[model samples]
Target: MTQTSNRIFDEMARLMNDAAGVAQGVRREFDTLFRAQAEKMLRELEVVSREEFEAVKEMARLAREENEALKARIEALEGKTVAKASKKTKDSEPPTSAPEA
Candidate 1:
């Protein structure tokens, strides 16, 4: 009787172990399927990856900085031009003396 009970318990333990293994395998398969589906959806959405987004963002920043620098240079050149024109006009004008004795 004791031998029969020991055999039954061993069989039950073996079945339990097999069920746990199957459960793990199913979980792994489900994860793979989920990941694939998610990737497909994202691709269809045409979303940009983080790396590509960062690259474009950096490019935009550089363009903005260049634009600002160019604006500053234009302003400086215009100031210099105005200064030169004023100086030239002053030099060309004749000095007038009022009632020279």
Candidate 2:
């Protein structure tokens, strides 16, 4: 009778262990499925990756800097042209003089 009881208890313990293993496997599969679905959703939304965003941001920054530099150069050239025109006007003007005594 004692040996029979031991065999039954041993079988029960083995069954419980198998059930725990199966539960763990199901949990792992669920996690994998959830991750796959999330990735698919993000792709469908056309979300940019971090690397692509950073690259485009850097390009925009560089373009802004170039535009600013060009604006400064244009202003400097305009100033020089105005100064030259003023100088030419002064040179072309007749000099004023008092009548001789």
Candidate 3:
């Protein structure tokens, strides 16, 4: 009985070692394949990284802000011109004479 038990223990240990080795090999192969694929994709597509994207987004925001400011300034100038034109029309009109008593 003791001899049988020892044999079983030895078999279990060997199986466990085999499983561990296989797992390690699979992990290494997956790592290598994934890195190669990632490199290939990066070379094929001209994709911006997160940091570069953020910087360009910030620049766009600033440009939008400047555009809005310029639009507001143009609107203000237009308003002033309209007001001046109306004032000139009013000033040019002759006053009516009052009725004599």
Candidate 4:
């Protein structure tokens, strides 16, 4: 090949390599922008993160368990109160007298 044609080919190859590099850089920048925008949108929507949801779920579970325990404790106290009232009533009542002929 002539020297001029070889030079032209080398110039074209260099241009193509530079264009490819620029395209790659643009793609990376676009990906970064898209991810940032997506995260911002999610935040605006008030979306809960997985960690926050899990923590709230666990707290609710614990609260439900505590409520059940309190209910049981109240029932036990009610039973004791009723028993004491029954004993008091029995002790206060007088004995019945026999009937006349």
Using all chains and alpha carbons, the TM-scores for the candidates as numbered come to 0.80, 0.71, 0.70, 0.66
TM-score of 2: 0.71
Pairs of residues at least 3 apart in sequence or in different chains that clash in candidate 1: none
Please write out the lDDT profile of model 2 over residues 30-96, one tens digit for every residue: 9999999999999999999999999999999999999999999999999999999999999999998
lDDT of candidate 2 at residue 97, scale 0 to 100: 94
lDDT of each: 0.98, 0.98, 0.97, 0.99
Taking the tens digit of each residue's C-alpha lDDT, what string does model 1 give over 1-101?
99999999999999999999999999999999999999999999999999999999999999999999999999999999999999999999999779868
RMSD, each candidate, Å? 2.4, 3.4, 3.0, 4.1
Give every collision pair in model 3.
none
Once fitted onto the true fold, the runs of candidate 3 whose alpha carbons sit more than 4 angstroms away are 1-4, 96-101
Give the poorly placed runs of model 1, Cα more than 4 Å off. 94-101
Flag regions of model 2 displaced more than 4 Å: 1-17, 98-101
Among all candidates shown, the one with the greatest TM-score = 1
Better of 1 and 3 by lDDT: 1
Prediction 4 TM-score vs. true? 0.66
